[model samples]
Target: MFNRRQLLGAGAALVSTAAWSKTANAGLPEAAIMETAATQPPLHPQSGPDYNPVVTLNGWTLPFRMNNGVKEFHLVAEPVEREVAEGMTAYLWGYNGQSPGPTIEAVEGDRIRIFVTNKLPEHTSVHWHGLILPSGMDGVSGLSHPGIPTGKTFVYEFDLVKSGTFMYHPHADEMVQMAMGMMGMFIVHPKDPNFRRVDRDFLIMLNAFDIDPGMYVPKVMTMLDFSLWGWNSRVFPGIDPLPIGKGERARIRVGNLTMTNHPIHMHGYDFAVTCTDGGWVKPEAQWPEVSIDIPVGAMRAFEFDAIYEGDWAIHCHKSHHTMNAMGHDVPTFVGADKRNLTKKIRNLQPEYMPMGTAGMADMGVMEMELPDNTIPMMTGWGPHGPLEMGGMFSVVKVREGLTPGDYSDPGWYQNPPGTQAYEWTGELPEPRKAADAQTQITPRPGSHNTAG
Candidate 1:
């Protein structure tokens, strides 16, 4: 155990070095030395390297080196600039120079050694949130193990006993750390290469932040009123689409670290909830679903065959979750009289404009002023018009003749002629009224009817 004074002193010394290794001291066996080979076994053997890479959008995959039979990964915990949207960047604490950290990929039954170095001003600890590990390695600060002091390195060596989708975040000062976007995905592949194989496997972390408009740091205290929602810490337009070949087995592992649950909805295909962090769901227990609601601190893996050849919608079903920086307290003025109010306000303030008077859908097309480094409430221009999409929204592009290894964006789908909705030019139909109907309203004997 380290006292506050000792921890502070030790932390200061460790931060000076780039990244302190456990082998700094002379106590390493020949077999345990790090491997320097450029090529190694793929994390997901079933799907080759190209197809198995998890599309993190603005994030990245954590790289590692093999040592004997064990894999070692170094994670640096520090404040990083994360672009939540194209123009919106937030100062968040994460691992290896990115927020929502980097995805840790491993194979089941592999001995793994992870070294986490804290670079933040305050102390922190990395809790392997859903991994089954020894009590000390569980990483609950003050409970299972002492929190890592600032600038200090801590080693966690354990065998990945199971294969599933898991997550990691700070257990010490969890609220503040997680709210500042400290989290990551940990994926363990099955030892058997053929087990649960998929052609395209991708992962994403559903996260939320409460950065006020024009600000760069998220409010760590706000819970329910998060203005920025995202998949993989990135908003739409900035979020990349998932590209896959037509007629391939697609698997998407989604993990949520947000304050609320997300009902992830997909269009043009029905997928099955085939697995969870706990384990794989048996075929007898698995059921087909178009939307899967991942609760807070949980993960769900959905699988389906991409038989369609087009760009399909994939996003959270909650209307607000697909928008950015919307005012929650703004009154509903859909049918309210705002003519007099708008005139008076515009007279006093030339730029004043009564908003939401007609409806919010118009806000998507309205050229309203927005704060700097912030996205519009509703945005994203599509092939047809404004997509009116923002956070937690992206497209899954499935096309013919796509190379299995090529995950590049194929651009918007070009609808075939006569397949898309078009304007009516040759038809003119008169509105039908009840007066044209044969049946007419008649007064009852005792009713006080005015149509005599």
Candidate 2:
């Protein structure tokens, strides 16, 4: 997860360079850059209309300055080294300093000026996805305006006519650029603070990468078989846990930039989809859901009251999405008898172990040797035992009694007496063989019909 919006919101410089003098906008603001990947505190409104800030999980907000009546921000699109997990890293193209670039937040009707400096090797342009603006500022290269040539800065001035969840990415060479992790979340708060407000607001951009083991850059050619699925360019347990106050209301806005859909499921509470990229869903139109299926290139905002206090899981329901670096072509050995093969393989290498006879859960607890800069297929140690999980996974740590704006992890939730599930040692009935059955009516366990 990314951190240090404070560095920009409060300080605004991780070695920011001088604005390009060749550009038209002479008074462009300094392009704030993030240097770390820790989840920093939310940037409260230093100026402009006051609305509750959103916490970008493993990410940060792009800082802006008030120039005249318009809010100004600088976005430098360049190469960045993003840590996908503890041992893995990827060199990707993104805005500012990280892949799935720093979030952009503004009000409903504020006039905004964004200076985009292309530090990339090739021509680039930033497309404001899902924003209402004039044709010239739409950022569609060759259609609205030409790409900002390398080492040049271009200004995009537009008015935020409406408020909703949105996204941003490159329009020029979109396939290669987006596949290399060039995307970000754009959240526009309502002009009126009380219009669908929540105590804790959070954002997550679902992204994926297809980097091979020991590689530094993602392989852009790979399509649906991404090896790593991430939230804001970070995998779990690298993804920061959402710390929620016991009785406070919370909102989670998720934007999917991947090639496929992801059904985000949250344990312990049923929420309602309050908003989308199109607009806010009316209160009467909201429907209760424990899991919301977000389609490709779309966004969904769900809200709920943090009633039950627990270390509830919030992750994609697709099983493969939870395993890191586990490729699609790995041969299945669930029912194959590898005992004989293991003997032959062990003769050549004494440490070779045949797995997946019963299941692959052993991979989570076993500390086997792996390649450098490679995340395990299944990892993470929980309070009980190994989590046996990996990508697109995070915990919502809800606890009682703490600071009102505390976003720190509350550790694992403690279950009350006799509340946790325990092992059962009781015996069950035995199965009768087909030979022992008299006249069988239907086929049952260990029992079959006489006629095929």
Candidate 3:
């Protein structure tokens, strides 16, 4: 195998040889490369309105340019290295950089022009989920339009007539493409900025993966038995917390593309579903909820006041969705007699030990070896103890002095004196046993005599 320096030299030599051969074959003094007509001119300056960009954890918004009064944004679909969780990385195909690509924020009434460059080995198309547009630009890949060929560019132009939380993904070979993590959120801010103002806005995409142990790519065929559940392609410990100002109105927009529904639960606030992909929900029709279930292929936007200041948990209510790399085939060992089996196994392996014969909670915090590129079923260190939680979990940090535009992590919260939950240290009182049933129930003598 060649070392780094040797590989660099070899790559340079190959490039130089290729260039010389191309020039010689052309019979020209120098190789001439012509630009294609599809390569449009650089965008020009515009005096159009812009939306208040929301901070998406492990994601970002695409910047747009005004090209002759049209909002132009570019998306490149290609392979990317995504950190699925701490110490676990997956090879995925996404737009620009990360899986669950950058958010696209726009204002209503803007003439939007999006250029999609396909860099995948296979053909793909971008479907603007829940967006109103011309049928030709629907990006259905052979149904509404032809698929964007590999190494080719396709431009989608349309007028944004409605404003709501939307999503985008590939319609061509969706199963394989989406399984490899190709998706993003699209937010069209209302033209009237103050119509529904929010101090802080956040967005997260719910997705799952079935990348087995020691595997780099996800098994696209595995649908119902996904192991790696996450928000924005990131597990609990890998996800960033949502920072907001206390007493400020906040909005969280979530889009689900996974096979399962996620009942998103929040610790400290009761939020109302304010908007859907279709449109806004009227105030009278809205109800307060601590958890909201988001179905697959749907988007929901919830809003609430950050009245309590602390590190509040926000996660999927499904217990399994909160775990990492758990094996479904592992046998239930609880209450099983393994003393003789352990001795026989250790005689051959010298280090085999029987575990989970009682319960599985200890495995959450146990220090055990795991397969390469695989995360623990539960892992995270908390102030109190091992959090023993992973996947689809994060915190909402509400601080007293945070600014509306501030996106920096405020760090862990500090509770007031004697406020945090702690174990009771006082002496326990003796338990009062219930009186015997025979002593408590006294039958009448006359009734017993009559019965006899």
Q: Highest lDDT, which number?
A: 2
TM-score of every model versus the real structure: 0.84, 0.91, 0.83
lDDT of 2 by residue, 184-252 (tens): 988889999999989999999999889888887988888798899899999988999999988999999
Ranking by TM-score: 2, 1, 3
| Winning candidate number (TM-score) | 2
The predicted structure with the larger lDDT, 2 or 3, is: 2
Off by over 4 Å in 1: 1-53, 425-452
lDDT of 1: 0.77
Q: Which of the two candidates, 1 or 3, achieves a greater lDDT against the reference?
A: 3
After TM-score superposition, the amount by which residue 379's alpha carbon in candidate 2 deviates from its true location, in angstroms, is 0.6
Tell how far residue 306 is off in model 1, in angstroms.
Answer: 0.9
- The per-model lDDT (C-alpha) reads 0.77, 0.86, 0.78
Which of 1 and 2 is ahead in lDDT?
Answer: 2
Candidate 1 residue-wise lDDT, 1-452, digit = tens = 22324323433433233333466722221111111111112233222232244545445455555555566667778888877766788888887667778778878888888888788999999899789999999999999889999967788889999888899999999999999989999988788767888887888899999988899999999969999898878888778888889889989999999999999999999999999878899999999999999998899999999998888999999999999986688767765667777787787898876667557767678887777878887888888888988999999999988887666778888988887888889968996658656765544355542210
Q: What is the lDDT, from 0 to 100, of the residue 12 in candidate 1?
A: 40
Clashing pairs in 2: 1-58, 2-37, 2-38, 2-58, 3-38, 3-40
